[model samples]
Target: MGNNQPTEKSVSDTISDAFQPILETPILNIISEIFQPNLEIIPKYSEPPNYNKEVTNVYILKLTDDKYYVGKSNDPSQRYLDHATESGSAWTRKYKPLEIEKVIKNASHFDEDKCVKEYMSLYGIDNVRGGTYSSVRLTNAQKGLLTQEIRGAKDCCFRCGRDNHFADKCYAKTNVHGENLPPKKKIVQSRININELELLSSETSSD
Candidate 1:
């Protein structure tokens, strides 16, 4: 009779076929692990730092009287408390319960002074004080004198002894009402006298 049992080669082929699926299972798992969405949780990204956070800032406060106060402070919150308690400037004291309208942070004194001047320009020079305000108006003669005096000046003001401003333009030299001292009549008289003397000298020289 022909052999009814499977041949050795056929048995080996059956074993190989059975092991193929088993070998493929581990490779399939590896591929799924590589391509599968990550199951491990990851930490969320953090928010960026706020560069505009107020530190040594310029702030504008709207007051109860409908006026505005422009101020500069390293800590605006503390300054606000001073203003609310009437320990601030006279202007802020008169107009109580100020609310901060805007803040400009991370600025130098020059920048703060610039902001204050801009606010003054928009609202009115009298809106705020104790910082830079409207520049004092100089008469032609006063400007001439100021120019002459400042030709060799290491500093600005002769009156307030400040560096960057002339005597006539110094706010500290102003009266309590913020008006400049009346232009010295003595200087005017001296100028007129000198002019007259020059005229007389010229007439004599012509003769």
Candidate 2:
């Protein structure tokens, strides 16, 4: 009788057999997913970006009316979008079909204002509206000087020559006589006399 012993499979074949399901399962799952009916794909939505607040930029936009508008905003792209989509400003609304022509980033607010004003001058004062371009925005010092000029009035202070303060409040007037002092304090004796007459009349009426 011939000795018959079953030969064991190679170690490599066993290892391959063990890993076959592991490798093939994923591929089969992928194929099933592809061929599956009514497959709903979950949309991959990215998170919205944070808005940049410190984007001081000057922008120039051209309108359908063949006019260019110079303006400033923190975000020029968003501002342009607003001018295009949002029907807010009358100028933009009337003009319509607006497009951004130029952008100057990282500009000072004052410089932006100056640029807009210069553009307004070049275009026409009536064509521009709002912002410092329409009115001069003065600094605190400039405002103070303006206040002084207004207070100076027609008659100027001879002492300091500063118009902001009245002559009575003037430092030079402090030493001056009656003219410098606010009109003398007058005691209204008439009121007291009227009160006495009223009391006397009431008393007489009671008698």
Candidate 3:
């Protein structure tokens, strides 16, 4: 008697058999005819990534629109993936980075500072943010400047340019009296006599 056995199908054969009928069916043709082509074209995939992707501390992100975010991370690729998944920095998620614009070779935060400053200058301060040391320094500097501005306005008289009192309580309310002798006493006065009026009202009510 001759030996006989059934041959096993290959993976290619199995897959072909499964999809061959679907490919040959007229339903695809019917569907194609029934529906108009989609108006939106699928964008081509991004170019091949840099193979030498070392985790440099600083990276720039190009927003989907007109904005930028400079950042630092040990694993920039993973950080990017986090951004894509919406679990990364709130800025990156909100703006939606189109791509990692550039990865700095240096891990120094000073370099990050330079990048952040450049982006802020180019795109306007409102449009850019991030970096480790840069963020802190910028924030501190901004806060300091704002505080100084506030204090300067409060500590000097706009009318007389005196450092003793505010403009609202200045002796020379409207006069640009040039820098002269400082006021001997604090100008503890207001345009409205609220306390006197309130005192009069209280006395009248009591009477």
CA lDDT scores, all candidates in order: 0.63, 0.61, 0.67
- What does candidate 2 score on TM? 0.36
Over the stretch 133-156, how does candidate 2's per-residue lDDT look in tens digits? 323234676434533443343355
Off by over 4 Å in 2: 1-55, 133-207
**Whole-model lDDT for model 2 versus the true structure?**
0.61
Best by lDDT: 3
Per-prediction TM-score, please?
Answer: 0.38, 0.36, 0.38
Give one digit per residue, the lDDT tens place, for model 3 in 88-155. 77777678878998887646646676677567645655577676422323576784443344345446
What total of clashing residue pairs does each candidate reach? 3, 2, 0
lDDT of 1 by residue, 1-207 (tens): 988996567887889998987677788797887789765776678998765663467777888755677778988888989989989877777777557888777775567656654564445444543354423343577444533443324444555434566665555745323446544333334335888889999999999
Worst 10 residues of 2 by lDDT: 173-182
| Deviation (Å) of 148 in candidate 2 | 22
